[model samples]
Target: METTRYSVPFSPLQERIAREAPQLSAALNHLLQAMGASDFEKYINSLSALKKVDDHLLLITKKEMYRSVLTGRFLPVIKECFAVKFVRIVSQ
Candidate 1:
């Protein structure tokens, strides 16, 4: 993969969103400690107990340490979603 450097200062949200995986993994580890042991049940309960985890882990994160690791290269995923939406419309 080709790496391009961004010259602008990154905002907290931007950085956090960027480094979601590791920050989330870290967050999950912390959450796991609260849940005690790991399993699907713990996962589900954590989701329910920590609403932000879903959105933050999957979306939000003011923590920027994980930013460099994430690539917001989900354009293809967005394109696929748009295509699927179009198909659904045509079928309807």
Candidate 2:
């Protein structure tokens, strides 16, 4: 079997995201629900979840499975909840 590993380089931004991970996840869930995207709640829960960085919302995930699944499909909805310039999906 072959295994693919994912890693996130350490940085101040990464640390900030780590600290606010839970709160950010909750806020995102609430926002998704408020926008009548309740159906996506379950899906979002499965992924690593999101956090707001300087001018972007970073989607952190460990598994390659989700990295491929997330893409930028939710960028618009995410922007509605967060006023970031972009949404980036990165592996941790």
Candidate 3:
């Protein structure tokens, strides 16, 4: 079995906030709400117009980001997230 992992690059805004802030939970929550209300999904859906990705891993990566934020743990969280999110698991 070959697994392919696709890494979704974070928006510059998201990365900046995550790296610099300790309390962005509320910000993310609000941002998500705003995105939903404004039909942001359509914009997100267009990212992979050039290619297809695994939605499951995309979600896992997002969860990993939240976990990292909540725990304030770096390194492994970031590493695992990069690996899981960007590294396509291709099993042959």
Global lDDT of each candidate: 0.30, 0.59, 0.35
Ranking by lDDT: 2, 3, 1
The TM-score between candidate 2 and the true structure equals 0.49
Q: Which pairs of residues collide in candidate 2? A: none
lDDT for position 18 in model 3: 51
Stretches off by above 4 angstroms in model 1 are 1-20, 38-92
Instruction: Please identify which of the two predictions, 1 or 2, would achieve the higher TM-score against the true structure.
Output: 2
Q: What are the per-residue Cα lDDT tens digits for candidate 1 across 13-47? A: 32342355343344444433543453312222222
lDDT of 3 by residue, 1-92 (tens): 99999997745334444555435434334544545633323322222211113422222223333434423433233224333334221111
* Per-residue lDDT of model 2, residues 1-92, tens digit only: 99999998544322343476655655565556754554354345445655677777777766665666566455566666666778787776
Q: Return the TM-score for candidate 3, rounded to 2 decimals.
A: 0.24
Provide the global lDDT of candidate 2 against the true structure.
Answer: 0.59
Question: Highest lDDT: which candidate?
Answer: 2
TM-score of each: 0.24, 0.49, 0.24
Clashing pairs in 1: 19-66, 19-67
